[model samples]
Target: MTIADKGPRTRPFEANWLARIGWLLLALYVVYAGAQLGFSWQRFSDGLGQGGKFIARMFPPNFTRWELLMSGIVESLQIAVLSTVVGIVISLPVGLLAARNLMPAWVTWPARGFIALCRSFHPIIVAILFVKAVGFGALAGILALIIASIGFISKLFAEAIEEISLKQVEAVRATGAGFTHILIMGVQPQVLPRFIGFAAYQLDSNLRNSTMVGIVGGGGIGATLFTAYQRFDYDFVLAMLIVIVAMIMVAEIVTGWARKVFQ
Candidate 1:
């Protein structure tokens, strides 16, 4: 071997001084920002005292308004299920169209733009708009959640489609299959499980969001909880909070089960 053939020796690992300095600067900025926000020990101490009293008032939550609670819960469930279905149906086509690897620029651009518009506003803001436009109710909540679902699931579906093996799609095409047939045989099989998983997640998210949308007059358990809060019905508020927490936990369990089943 010629001496000139060997490259210079180098360390196997080296520290990045720039990253370390950046991290130090970030830490310093956080401290500076906190100081600027007027963080003080005395205010924290006072907050703790208030928190204790608030907890004391929340014990032994009232559940006497079972009928009202049940109605709200049922409405929320309906919103979640219906919105998930509508979103899944719509997202499938849009997502397929948006996949850059599968579609031309003309197709992907419009599909992507639509998804971006849907996601531009938070669901709460969308709910507020629908509430004002539709004059408030479960309809508004459902519409808002449907938009949210479409915005979210469509993006995932597009990316999933993009990541699929083009070789499989080409193989289907080799048999002189039409576009629809190629998509069904090559793409749908790859992404169906993922689509199901995303749908389950969206349903769970919709259930939680449905409760909050009602606070803005969109209709659900949130409306009842908001009313209880306005009336200073602390015990009932506590009961509602507990129920919401339980509902969310149950949804998490169900979604986990669904993902496993589909996987």
Candidate 2:
């Protein structure tokens, strides 16, 4: 064909004017917002210097109150474990009920609404409320984590169930199987692996939250850390932070192993 007869060559890349304009607007808004909020590089630099000095005071951590530290850590662990276990058990049925493909609208809507309510607030806010209701201690922390776990695990579980192969479910039904039998033979196989992974993740999250819940009087190391901070015991605060980090790292390892074994 003649060169002139060929169609126009298209560029490999095209500039999207709409996206470019959107990004430009976003940058402009950020600058305006920063100005309004008094955000300046000079202020940030000064804050960093102060933060460094505060961090310096945390060294040479005090371990003289080892008994108190140990008790708090143990309580946090108990809260995490109990909440994770209870949440997983409760999540199974709630998740099944919330699955749109499995349950009717009447059932699914209520279950979904309950899940949404559980997720509507932060765990710390929930912990505070539970502390008031239950009158504090580890019980409040456990209840708070349980609510958080239910919200997260149930939603994911429902989504997983919804994504399962309907063909397997139909096949099981064709065999004159009941709902329980079909769930066991068809649905469980597809979603169990994912559910286990979600449960492990919730456990890890609960472990971290258990520490924070104590700050609100839910009972954990967070209460101890808060007390240390109030008393200007930076050294003790550093010790608690170190212990919390170590506990989280160990929990992560255990959860990873559990996921691998389950999968």
Candidate 3:
């Protein structure tokens, strides 16, 4: 048969010239952004020299302020734990109500709105607001982190509930179980592990954020770190950094252990 007679035979896709041009335009935009951000070789070389000087000044980190550091760490721990507990307690009902399949529109809409409001701002900004509202210190930080945790976990929890096996739920209902009973027996079992995972993750994040909220006078290690920065005490700053890193690592390990135990 002649090639022309074969007509439109299927063939491998060839790269369109338009697509190639689009990629070329994207590359040009990246280069433009780099230039706008002052990402030049000369600027990088200068930054390295300044960084080396900063590093030299940070050597032999002073730990003479051990008492202050310990106090701040303890306060941060309290804030984190308090926020996690409060957030988890509040999230359970809100999450259940936000699950569309499980709740009427009147309930779901308000629950979703509450979640959105909680998530509307960064934790630091929320902490600042709380500090203004309720006065500063660990209380403000705890309240802020609690709001953030509720926003995060509740939304995820609702999604987890929505994705659960409907067949199991149907079977429970068929056994003449009421809505509450079905939820307790069929729905809770399916999503409990994931809910635990989310709670642990929120606790870990709250620990890290509790430290940062102190920078804004909400109370924690961050306040001391900010004071050290104001005094140009880079050695103390380095010491604080080391301790913060250790705390985060320990939190991560503890969270992992909890997840494993619960699983």
Model 1 RMSD, rounded to 1 decimal: 3.8
Which residue segments of model 1 deviate by more than 4 Å?
1-17
| Whole-model lDDT, model 2 | 0.94
Worst 10 residues of 2 by lDDT: 3-12
Backbone Cα, N, C clashes tallied per candidate: 0, 0, 0
Best by TM-score: 2
Q: RMSD in angstroms, all models?
A: 3.8, 1.9, 2.9
Which candidate, 1 or 2, has the higher TM-score? 2
| Ranking of all candidate structures by their TM-score, best first | 2, 1, 3
Q: Give each model a TM-score.
A: 0.90, 0.93, 0.90
Clashing pairs in 2: none
Query: 161-237, model 3: which lDDT tens digit per residue?
Result: 99999999999999999988998999999999899899999989999999899999899999999999899999999
Q: How close to the true structure is residue 211 of candidate 1, measured as C-alpha lDDT? A: 85
Give the alpha carbon lDDT tens digit for every residue of 1-263 in model 1: 88666888666788899999999999999899989999988999999999988888888898999789889988988888888899889999999899999999999999999999998998989999999999889999999999999999999999999999899999999999999999899899999899888898888889889889998988889899999889978889999888888988999998999899889
Error of 3 at 158 (Å): 0.1
